[model samples]
Target chain A: DAGITQSPRYKITETGRQVTLMCHQTWSHSYMFWYRQDLGHGLRLIYYSAAADITDKGEVPDGYVVSRSKTENFPLTLESATRSQTSVYFCASSATGTNTEAFFGQGTRLTVV
Target chain B: GESVGLHLPTLSVQEGDNSIINCAYSNSASDYFIWYKQESGKGPQFIIDIRSNMDKRQGQRVTVLLNKTVKHLSLQIAATQPGDSAVYFCAPRQAGFQKLVFGTGTRLLVSP
Candidate 1:
């Protein structure tokens, strides 16, 4: 009952449609991250937030937007979904920067048709 | 030379046997590393971690070995069980950043 959780564990949308994936953590971790997993690429960070209102782009942030309005919530949005955006999205939270354990949510599988 | 990779993409071992998964990293500046286990349709869970200052770290039935000399890292599971079947990824923590670069991942299949 006290862990990270992602909304709509699965999503399906058509191309050019907007989609938002929600991530929530109960631990109130300061560091929250969004990553996309595709075949051949283990996990690519899309965006991360150090704290409320503080966000930064990761390796592959194009076509994606993220906001951290609260310490427990970080949401990722795809302005316009594309087939390439179809992948498993993972949300993780850490207490600090280095030498900290990251807790992950169940993940959301998005499909863009 | 700051990439993390694995020698094998998949490994199959009989249940109750030991399993060794290998990983190689190129960043000498990376001081921390972690091993994550991800089951199908789920997010990766942290299994174990090790820092550059140490060569080995153990947790429960898992052990992580870090060889900074060759930029290699390994995870060994003793008496592997069916529950251990999952995709294991090795991630090396960047020196001055919170971002972790993950390896391709090794799929471990345990046979009963």
Candidate 2:
């Protein structure tokens, strides 16, 4: 497909385990972002990358880690997944960070038990 | 403190009626705002956007109104259809910031 895609549409893991959600975009956008959606919180940005190898923390980036080595791929990793970390993750990309509309992926549903 | 919140959690309207979903933001300095529609098991898709400088912007069937004085944003859908049933979110972002903050979202149900 030519749009953004997220891998492992659904995942289940135990607490203290490490899990990663993958995101790939074919548009070659300059900005890629990771966001977690939970009940009552809507979508909170976990991390965002302005370009390859230039990632920054977002609103809720405490337990989540993200890296963008390539413009097409941005993966989010949970160092030590906790029960509270169970939420739906969405990956989005935009041509630029300012005033540009972002396109989102299908989303990854992660369940931590 | 960044907070964007929707006034209604759920809205039920007739298929031919005009639906309005309202959102309020705490940040008065936010210049950019966007409305997204998310169906079941899918990511949010952009519908319309309005900037702080503009009070209202219209799309194909959607209209977004921005009230910078009250920090209120609204999305109005004309002639609502069954396909319009989805969760709508309003996101606000300050200029020059990479982070986009989304609201809790309001579920719009169109009854035919």
Name the candidate that leads on DockQ: 2
List clashing residue pairs in candidate 2. none
Q: After superposition, how far is residue A93 of candidate 2 from its true place, in Å?
A: 0.7
| Backbone clash tally (model 2) | 0
* Clashing residue pairs found in predicted model 1: none
Looking at candidate 1, what TM-score does chain B attain?
A: 0.97
Error of 2 at B101 (Å): 0.7
TM-score of 1: 0.97
- Compute DockQ for each candidate against the true complex: 0.76, 0.82
lDDT, candidates in the order shown: 0.93, 0.92
Instruction: Report the lDDT tens digits of candidate 2 across residue range B1-112.
Output: 6798899999999999999999999988788899999999999999988778899999998999988989999999999999999999999988777567899999999999
**Fnat of candidates, each listed:** 0.69, 0.82
TM-score of each: 0.97, 0.97
